[model samples]
Target: MSTGKFIVIEGMEGAGKSSAIAVIESILNKQGIAYINTREPGGTPLAEALRDMVKSVEHQEKLTVETELLLMYASRSQLLANKILPALAAGKWVIGDRHDLSSRAYQGGGRGFEQSIMDTISDITLKGFRPDITLYLDIDPHIGLSRAKARGNLDRIELEQMDFFIRVHNKYRELAAQDKAIITIDAAQTMVQVHQDIEKVVIEFIAATDLD
Candidate 1:
């Protein structure tokens, strides 16, 4: 049987990833595709635990940047090994809420980690696996943070200062431009318009994948 395709939704907080995923799910349902959805740093049991540790604002001691990066990859390894690979092998498409691209943007770009270090860690964790397509919802850091704050409590990362998020935003844009598999969507638009743009890209991807 052919391996199932992997599609990922990527963006900084408040970029409307949940809404975009809903649109993809609707399209996949209409196409009668069998699929599963997963999220980064929290997909499986161990990963979920790690996710909590990383996100919990209650940590009396700050989580070091290096520890945070490793924790992210550790969770990814579990999810990939115990869930994602098996699902794809079973020919079930996977809709991912976030993936390695998050690391590339957040840790590599936002944290200012060297590309070589990022490359080394990525190779160790992912080997060569990657999503077939990633829809990146792009928005200004100021705007995105406002939206996130309005939704209520922010995570440890979300609680980061505005300047930190600005760095993340720049990294996201930089990496998205260089990668063909990554499709950028202007998320500052009205929800109606953002959803429309996402729907159009997903439909096109589905059509192309079906042909392939």
Candidate 2:
């Protein structure tokens, strides 16, 4: 049996990942493809719990950098083993809200962890497994944060200062540049245009590959 593809949508807070996912889903539906949607630091029950622990502002004690980084990987491990791998084995495409890239950008860049640390942990957890494609919605942090603020109360990560997001934004671009599997989309455009760019990418991928 053929294995299904994995598509990851990555970006800073309010970089229009949700909108991009919607566009991808629409394209998949039109093509009659099967896929399961997931979110990083989330997806499985255990992962969701980890997500809450990491993101919930209700926590009295602040988690250290190492602790937070490990938790993020822990959540990712659960999602991969319990959801992603199984779905792919069954020939179902996986559409993810965020994935391993988030850690590299957020913890490695935003938190200023060493690249070696990030690579070591990622290798341990993922063992070289990666998304077939990563759609990175490139957007200015100021703009993205403004949009995020309009949504509601910000999560712990979302509440980070401007410089933190700038680092994340830069790291995302740096990684995307090195990885050919990643596709960058101009997310600063109107939501309609963002969706169109996402659809164009998805359509091209579907047309070029015969996963079925």
Candidate 3:
């Protein structure tokens, strides 16, 4: 039996991930490919709850960095075991808004956790499971945050200092540079251009994987 592919759309807030997702879905639909859409720190019941807890700004005391990192992994573990793996085993592709890379960028970079610690936790949590293709929409933090703010109220993570997002952005570049599966798209470009780039990547991936 053929194993299904996993495609992850990763980037900072307002990096045009939603638009990219739409483009990918549209292409897959036209090609009659089957897929399930999901997001990390989310997707399962438990993961959604974790998402809320992590994003909520209602905590009386500041949430500890360790707690935040652990919750992210906990949510990811649930999503992977209860949703992602099963869908792939059933031969259905998965389209994810975010994935393990988020943790590496946000927790390891933005939050200043040691790379070794993040690697150990990730290795234990995911057992080396990774996306077959990652479309990383690269954008400057200032531009991304400006876009994010225009959309709605900022979440806890979104409310972080500009420097935090800079670190996150840098980490994304670092990780993408090292990983062949990740394709970096310049999100600072116009929407039309961004979508064009995304479609080009998706088409190539589909052809290579024979997903069509």
Tell me each candidate's TM-score. Answer: 0.97, 0.98, 0.98
- Ranked by lDDT, the better of candidates 1 and 3 is 3
Give the per-residue lDDT digits (tens) of candidate 3, residues 81-186.
9999999988888999999999999999999999999989999999999899999999999999999999989999999999999999999999999999999999
Estimate every model's Cα lDDT from 0 to 1: 0.92, 0.93, 0.94
Error of 1 at 164 (Å): 0.6
In model 1, what is the error at residue 85, expressed in angstroms? 0.7
Name the TM-score of candidate 3. Answer: 0.98
Error of 3 at 180 (Å): 0.9
Ordered by lDDT, highest first, the candidates read 3, 2, 1
For model 1, how does the per-residue alpha-carbon lDDT over 38-96 read when each residue is reduced to its tens digit?
99988999999999998999998989999999999999999999999999999889999
Model 3 gets an lDDT of: 0.94
Quality of model 2 by C-alpha lDDT:
0.93
